[model samples]
Target: MTTTQSSISSTSPTPTVPSGSGRVANIVLDSFTEAGRHVRIIPRNIEVLIFATIQPVMFVLLFSFVFGGSIQVPGYPDYDQYLMPGIFAQTVVFGSVFTSVGLAEDLSKGLIDRLRSLPIVQSSVLIGRTLSDLVRNIITFIAMLAVAFVLGFRFEGSLTSAAAATALLLLFSYGLSWVQALIGLSVGSVEAANSAGFLWMFPMTFVSSAFIDTRNLQYAWLRTVADVNPFTQVTNAARALYNGTDPGDAVMWSLVWSIGLVVVFAAIATRKFKTSSE
Candidate 1:
């Protein structure tokens, strides 16, 4: 009995995490590690990459060729150039649904439970997933850009301005990822999460200046909504920047909208993550 007691006592106690900076560092490190895991999984799930690439490519092709001739932009020489930026913006925004479906799958498979069993931070899983999705979005952007190039879409602006526009789109997509993360955590299944994720995006993208000029919308309310829609702001900003037109206040508003979304949705997602974990 004494030997048994000694043996039990001698066994190492469960490690205790240090408070303050150390804890924060651990969370950051764990987030990167989780992000790496997600990146690695992409190769095995090639269908995700394929499906993500196909829709945007098709959009770029169909809109540039079939619809380009009929679409009239008052100042643009070629409608294809004007259409590409909106297509890119729409693609990134739609890409965010991948985050929702991925998170829902993880939750359904009890991956969250398994991760929770470890010493990692609770929010790291969501952060990592979003980060990975951002990387994936970058890939999708490249593919779409290639397709756009083939369809006669050329950047009229300096390379620096073009890069800035790309960055803004990615930032906006990252913000939307957090919103999708919240949806994923809230929904019971992947299918439900996918549906819930795109339910708002359809209206959000269609009602904006993505395909048609906001001023052309027949409905007064739609024009008003499109004027204020963040997606419209981003799309318009991207179009101006890429086409070398004066962006006016569109860039500023796009930045504000993206930052606002990140702030709002990140908080909501973090809270939902904690609740779901418990």
Candidate 2:
């Protein structure tokens, strides 16, 4: 056991601080190294990769065909136009869950203990994990986009607007990846992380304007909840951009919310990662 632990601990080389002058560069380098390691493992674990790609595609098909015609959302008679962005928002949000599950799995396998013994930047492990998940999300997004286009979902907005919308959604999901980082570190096992990470998102996504416009919601309280929901801002912003509609302040508010979540959750999760132990 001692020898095995030593081998795992040696996976990363000692990082030099040099009175912290090179700390930022060190973090970038180390984080990239860790990210590459995680991404490379994806192919070896092909089953998980397949499921990750399949889920969002399945969602697009189901919502675009099944629930789409029955539900009438004003200003979106085509339905696919409005629904695609919401589904994109939801897909990226769900993609962030991999962070928690990945971190928890590493912890259970004693990888965290091994990383703690290394001299790398303390935050590199989490950053690298999240970055790798972002790459996965990008791939999933591309796959979903192809399917959406086939279903008559055109980018009604200019190319620039479409790109900006995609970037905003990715940024939002990346921010939530930090939140999941804390969840993964706080939980006892991968199963706990998986359950805890996903339990709240149903209400988070469903209660918002992701599926239906806030105006169409029958209940006042539900509409209020949807209005206050940050996810609503994100979905609306992306939806407006994709549809080439005047977003007003939705884009700005979404950017602020996304950046805020990233800054706040990254700090909290990094702090937790430092003191966490089995």
Error of 2 at 216 (Å): 1.6
The digit string of per-residue lDDT tens for model 2 on 101-143 reads 9999999998888987887888999999999999989988998
Instruction: Write down the lDDT of every candidate, Cα atoms only.
Output: 0.90, 0.90
Estimate the TM-score for candidate 1.
0.92
Per-residue lDDT, model 1, residue 206, is: 86
What RMSD, rounded to one decimal, does every model reach? 4.5, 4.4
lDDT of 1 by residue, 107-223 (tens): 899898999888788889999999999999998999889888887788899998999999999999999999999999999999999999999999999899888888888989989
Give the number of the best model, judged by TM-score: 1
Q: Over 4 Å off in model 1, which ranges?
A: 1-21
